[model samples]
Target: VFCMKGDYSFERIVSSDVDCINLKDPVPLLYLKDHPGLSYNDSSYSYGESLSEFLRKKDVGNYSCYINANSPLIIRKCPYDPYKHHGDDNGKVMKNCRDNGYYHESRDGACYLCRLEGKCGCEHYGFETFINPQKTNETGRVSACGSDHVIFSDDIYSGVEVIYNSENGLNEILYLDPHGHKVKYGMSGF
Candidate 1:
C-alpha cells in the first residue's frame, strides 16, 4: 500500500475516486489526492506511518459487545494521584507485570493480584479486575450493603467501544472512541 508522507489537504473538489479518472489507467484500492509526495509502498494509498487505510470499513455494520470498566482511558499521571481501577491502587503500576501482577494500595508487598484482563495492547495496558464485596468487606461497612470494586487502567484513551464485525473474526474490527480517534487491532483473543 502507498502512504501519504506529510501533512496535506485536498485542494480540488475530488468528491469520489472518479475525480482521478484521467490520472491513471485504473483506480487503486482507494482514491488519491493527486500529489507528487505520495509514495508507492505496497502499491496502495496509506494514511500515516502506521495507518494503512483511512477507516477501511467505511460501510461497517452495527457495533456491539462493549468493554467494561475502561471508558475514557484515565492515565495514571503520578503515584500519589488517586482514582485507580477499583477506585483505589491496584498495584499494576508498582508490581511489574514482568515480575508479578500482585500488589495493592492498601498494603505494600501484598501477594493478591487483580487478575482482571487488561484492555489495550498498546505500550501501556489499560484494564481492570473486579473485586468481590464478600471477600473485601468481611467486617466493615461492606457487610451492610453489597457493592463491587472496580479497578482503573492507566493511559485509558477512552471507554473502548468495540464493534463486532461479521467479516472475518480477526483484526478488521473497529474500536470507537467517543473522545478520540478509533483504532483497529487483532481480535484473536477477544
Candidate 2:
C-alpha cells in the first residue's frame, strides 16, 4: 500500500490493490536508516518521522513518501469530502435530497432551480422586465455593475424635446410630477 503524510492532518493511503497493512503502527527508524541507496535529504523523508510526531504534525501541507519497492512509492493529495461522501458508490452530489434540495453536510448547497436563477435569469423578460426594470432610476438610467457611467436607459418617453440650450448642446428637460413620477412630453428632438 502507498502511504504519505497528507496536508498534516492524517496519513493518506492510496492503493488499487486491496491489501491489509496496519499503517497506524510505528515505522521503525532502523528500517529507513539502513537504506543507503535511498536519500534522506528528500522532502519525502518527513513521512519517516515517528508515528506520534507524524500524527501531531498533521495539518494542511503537501508531502511525499518512498517505499523500498520496485515501483517508487507514490504520494497524492487526498480528495477532501467535508460531507463524508468519499466511499459512495453512486457519484451523486447528495445521497438523498434534503429540504434545501441538497445534503445537509454540503455547504451553500441549494435547489438546482434556485442556483440557475441566481447565476442567470431563466427567462429573457425575467431579467429585462422584472429584474433590470427594478434597478432603473427615475430618469430611466442604470449604472452597470462593473462600470462608472450609466450604460442603459429604459425611458418611458422615447420621443422627448430638448428644452434648454447649453454651451455644449441642447439639454433635455426631465419633469417630475407631484407623486414623484417622471413626466415626459412628446415634442420630438430640438
Candidate 3:
C-alpha cells in the first residue's frame, strides 16, 4: 500500500499492497537451508551472515516492496506473530499467518496498524510488538515493530532507526523520509 510512484512494478508492488515481498517477487530460495528460524541465526549457525544487511542486500538487489521514505524498507512480516501471540484469547491476535508452521509461513500480523490486507495508510513505522507476559524471556516487553511516519502524518515515514541489542534483540531497522532516502530492515529471534 506504499508506493510513491517511481515508475512502479514489482508486479506493481506485489499487486496492491506494498508490504514488501507480499508485493511478491522471486522468493524461492527453497527453504533457505535448515531454517535458523527463517535464517537469522544466533542459537545455531548460518555463518554466512544476515540478520539484517537489509535482507542480504534485497536478495542481491532485485528490490520488491520498495518504500523510500527518506530511505526505508525494513520488515518482519511475521516474527512468529508476536511469538504465537503469547497468551492469546481475544485480547487479540488469534494466529493464522498462513501457518507454514516454522521457518517461513506467517504473514498477517505486525504491520502494527498500517492494517494489512484491508490496507490502511500512513505508510508504515506503525510499530507494534510488545510481549511482556510477566517479563520472563529476560525482562521481556519487546516484540518488535515500528511505525513513525515522522510521528504519524499519513505518508512518507520519517526518521526511524531501531537497533535493539542488549545482545542481539532487534538488531537494526532504518526508515526515513523527508529527502534523505533510506530503507534498511533486519530481524531476529533465532
Candidate 4:
C-alpha cells in the first residue's frame, strides 16, 4: 500500500479476496507475496517496519510499504509554515503538497520537488546547513519560502532575474537577451 503524506492518521487493512478469509483482521499484504518469484529489495539504512506495523501510528506524514523502487520506506510529515503554504495554520496546506509546496535553497536557488518536513536540498547543494529563504519584496530578488515569494507555478522561464552562484555563493544580476533568455551581462554583450 502506498501511504501518502497524510495517511498516518487512519487504519489501512489489507485482506485476501478468497472465500473464508476473516475480514475483521485482515493480514497486512506484501507486494512481493502477490508477485511470486519477484526479487524483494530494501536499501534503506533502517529496515523499516511492515505496512501493518506502520499503519498503527497517527503521525501526520508520508510512508510506503515495500515499493519495488530502491527508495526507503520512510515516514515524514511537512511542518506547518504559515508563510510557505498559506495564511492559515489549520493544516489545510497539505493539499498544496505535490502541487506547489516546493522552494529552493536560500543560497543557490535551485528548485527541489519534495521537502519532506521542510528539509530542502541544502545538503545536495553542498551546504552543511539548511538556509531558509529570506523574506523580501524587491522586484528582482528571490525570497523562495517567504510570504510573497511562494513558488506557486512551475513556469521557471518567465520573469526571472537575479541568480545566485551555487559554487561561489555570490549573487549576480541577470539581463534578458534578445531571445528572452536570462544571461549575466559581461564582456559578451549588453
Candidate 5:
C-alpha cells in the first residue's frame, strides 16, 4: 500500500479483483495529456515527454503517482544473507536447480521440518515449532529460515497441492518408533 500525506492527490486507474482503495489496475492505458503531473516507470518504452513535461501536462500540483500491481508483495526486515541454505550453502544449488528447470513436487498438509524433507521429500524445506499454527494440508513446496519462516514458506507455495486425499490429510504418515516417539532421520532435526 502506498500513501502520500502532502499537498497532493492520486487516483487509481484500474483494478483486478476487489475494489480495494489501494489496488490499481494493471498496465492501464493512461492518457498523460489529460492527467498532468503524471509519471510512470516506462524506462524500456519511452513516453514521448520528459518527466517535467509530463508533470506539466497534468494540472495536479506536485503529485506523486504510484503504480502497484495486484501481485503479492513481501517485505523482509531481517539481516538475511540469501546465499545460505541449511549448512550446505545451497544458494548455488537452488539457483542451478531453478536454472536447469528442476521442479520439486508439492506435498499437501502442514509439515514440520523433519516431516517436510523426510516423509514428503517435496524438494521444499520448511520448519515449524509446536507453538505455531498448523498449516493447511495443501500440496506445495517451500523453504524458509528464521522467525518469519512459516509465513514465507506459505507464500512460496501458495495454492499448490500434489495429493488429493480426503480421508487422511497430507503429510499424515508419522514415522514413529516402538516407544511411540517420533523418529528423526536424514538430518531432519533443526
Candidate 6:
C-alpha cells in the first residue's frame, strides 16, 4: 500500500507478514479539481481536518472542494461564496460519477451508487429504497416496502448481506434479515 505524505509525496510499504500494520497517513481517497489550490477530506478519508476548516485556512479563489454527503469517498466542488450549495445549509452535494457531469438518478426499482470508474453503469453498489410519490396518490406505493440492497464486493455472487432502507417519501421501511424475512420500521427510524 502507498500512503501520501504531502501534496505529491508518497511512501510505499511492502509487507509479507499477515499481521503487519502501517499507521502512516493515507492518500486522499478522492480529488475534486475545479482549479489547483483547493483540496478536501471527508470523515472516511482519515485526514485530520474538516472541509469547513480547510476552506477557512486557505485563500480559495473562486472554487473549493467539500465532502459530498451521499458518499464520503466523493469530494464535491462549489463556488466559494455563499458558504455552500444553494439552499442546502448542510452542503450536501450529490455525486456526479458520469463524464458528462451529472448524477445517476434512482430508477428501475433500485438506488445506485456509482462506481469509481466514471460513466459506466453502477457495478459497485445498489439499493432498493423508498421512491418519491409523484402525486398524493401514487401507484406502487406500498404501505410497507422492504429493500433488496445489493453490494457487489468482487463483482460476483459472494455477498455480506445487510439491511437498510433510506427514506425518500414512502411511509415505512422494511429490512430483510439473513433468512429473507421482513423487519418493518416506521419512517421516523430511517
Q: What TM-score against the true fold does each predicted structure earn?
A: 0.15, 0.13, 0.19, 0.16, 0.15, 0.17
lDDT of 6 at 119: 20
Model 6: colliding residue pairs:
none
Give the per-residue lDDT of model 4 (tens digit) for 1-190: 4465654544477876332111110111132234332232231212134321232232212222212212112222224333233213332332232122232123332112223223322333311111112222333432221111112112212223332222244332221222322221111222
Candidate 3 vs 6: which has more lDDT = 3
List model 5 lDDT by residue over 1-190, tens digit each.
3446797766666655422222221111232334333333422112233322433343322211111111111111112222223113322332232223221112321233334233322344422211011223533332111111211232221111111112345231111122111111111221
Instruction: Count clashing residue pairs per candidate.
Output: 14, 6, 24, 1, 10, 0
Q: Candidate 6: where are CA atoms >4 Å away? A: 1-11, 14-114, 118-130, 138-190
The residue-level lDDT of candidate 5 at 100 comes to: 30
For 1-190, candidate 1 gives per-residue lDDT tens digits of 2345478544554353322111211111122233222233322222231111211222212211111111111111223223222112223332221122121222211111221222212233222211111111111111100001111122222223222222233221223243322111122122
- Backbone clashes in candidate 4 total 1
Residue pairs in candidate 5 whose N, alpha carbon or C atoms collide under 3 angstroms: 14-25, 15-25, 36-57, 36-58, 37-55, 37-58, 109-137, 109-138, 139-160, 139-161
Candidate 3 lowest-lDDT run of ten: 128-137
- Model 1 scores worst on lDDT over the 10 consecutive residues at 139-148
Kindly list the per-residue Cα lDDT of model 6 for residues 1-190, writing each as its tens digit.
6666668766677765331112211112322232233233432232223322333344322101122211222322223222112113221221111111121222322222232222222443322221111122122222211121221111111111121222355221121222222212111211
Range of the 10 consecutive residues with the lowest summed lDDT in candidate 6: 94-103
What does the lDDT read for residue 107 in candidate 2? 21
The residue-by-residue lDDT of candidate 3 on 52-158, one tens digit each, is 23333434221111221111122334454434342244212212221111222223222423333333223444332211111011332222122222222223232
Better candidate by lDDT, 2 or 6:
6
For model 4, the stretches where C-alpha displacement exceeds 4 angstroms are: 1-89, 106-190
